[model samples]
Target: MYRLLIVDDEDIITDGLYEVFNRYQPERLDVCKAYSAKEALDWMSRTRIDIVLTDIAMPGMSGLELSEEIQKYWPRCRVVFLTGHSEFEYAYRAIQMTN
Candidate 1:
């Protein structure tokens, strides 16, 4: 099974995503959620995750920073970031980093 970790500042947002993921049954991925970067890091250190879905603009450590750290530590894990910004710059950077 694919392990998935979700990071978002808002509990409701993560909860909604969890429900959606469950309803969609996205490849039977195991889902876990963290409301803060520190909490996410804690889980990451202890657990093995295949994918991470996170908000780009989060408190303390942003998703970009988290992804970079994950790249250095858990290189095989894939990161999918979400942002409220509709601008091209954020999307461009996200694509660039993921690619």
Candidate 2:
């Protein structure tokens, strides 16, 4: 099963994502939700997360920082960012850094 962690500061977005994933749970995927980067990190430290879907403009630690940390610890983990059009440059830089 593919384990997915969805991180966003907004509860509604996380809840909506969980609901959507739960509705169409193909490939036996498991979804977990976190409201902030800190929360996501805490959960990840104890669990084996296959994929991290995070927002770029979070309050404390940005998704870029989280993605870097995840790569350092879990090199094989996939990190996907959710960003606004204004944050395209940041996302581009992050993608470039990873490559």
Candidate No. with top TM-score: 2
**Residue 46 CA error for candidate 1 (Å)?**
0.5
Q: What RMSD, rounded to one decimal, does every model reach?
A: 1.8, 1.4
What residue pairs are clashing in model 1?
A: none
lDDT of each: 0.87, 0.88
Q: Candidate 2 on 1-99: residue-level lDDT in tens?
A: 989999999888889988898677666898999999999999899999999999888899988889989989899899988876585688687789578
lDDT of 1 by residue, 1-99 (tens): 888888999889999988777666667778888998788889999999899999988889988889888999999999999888787887787788976
What C-alpha lDDT does candidate 2 achieve relative to the native structure? Answer: 0.88
The TM-score between candidate 1 and the true structure equals 0.88
- Model 1 scores what on Cα lDDT? 0.87
> For model 1, what is the alpha-carbon lDDT of residue 85?
77
